[model samples]
Target: MFVRIVKMGFQPDKIDAFFENFEANKNQIRNFEGCLFLELYRDKNNTNQFFTYSYWEDEAALENYRKSDLFLKVWGETKVWFNQKPEAWSVDKVVSLE
Candidate 1:
């Protein structure tokens, strides 16, 4: 499987807005074709920082989603709330412990 991890830092005041948007759209993103799983995480000490971990069938699957209208809408609204540019990594699972 393909994995994607994205780190996002938002304006302190925009944290709640970002979370609300994620909650509203998580289902659609998870249900998108080739998506296997989706999850969100927040930093304990840095409340304004968040991370998204998702599993895709393959890199191409992820690329398709990135180019989709869903991404355009979500990212378009989301980028404005960022305090700094976001970061991301795409990788393959090396091993499984469970």
Candidate 2:
């Protein structure tokens, strides 16, 4: 499984808009091919910081979603709300915990 974690920093003033966009697009993103799981997280101390955690069948599947129109539309709207550049990680599980 391929895991993806994206940390995003939003402008405090733009937070509401950011969530509105997320609410509007999250399902479509989750429904994309090879997407196995999707979850959203917010910082405990810093409300403006958020993270997207998801699982894909593989890197290619993640890449395919990145290339899709949903990503373009979502990202285009999302970046404008950022206080800083987002950071992303693609990882593989090395240990099992279940």
lDDT of each: 0.95, 0.93
Off by over 4 Å in 2: none
Worst 10 residues of 1 by lDDT: 15-24
Off by over 4 Å in 1: none
List, residue by residue over 27-98, the lDDT tens digit for candidate 2.
999999999999999999999999999999998999999999899999999998899989999988788688
Counted clashes in each candidate structure: 0, 0
Model 2 C-alpha lDDT versus the unseen true structure: 0.93
Please provide TM-scores, in order, for all candidate models, with all chains considered together: 0.97, 0.95
lDDT per residue for candidate 1 within 9-43, as digits (tens), equals 99999988898999899999999999999999999
Leading candidate by TM-score: 1
C-alpha displacement of 54 in model 1, angstroms?
0.2
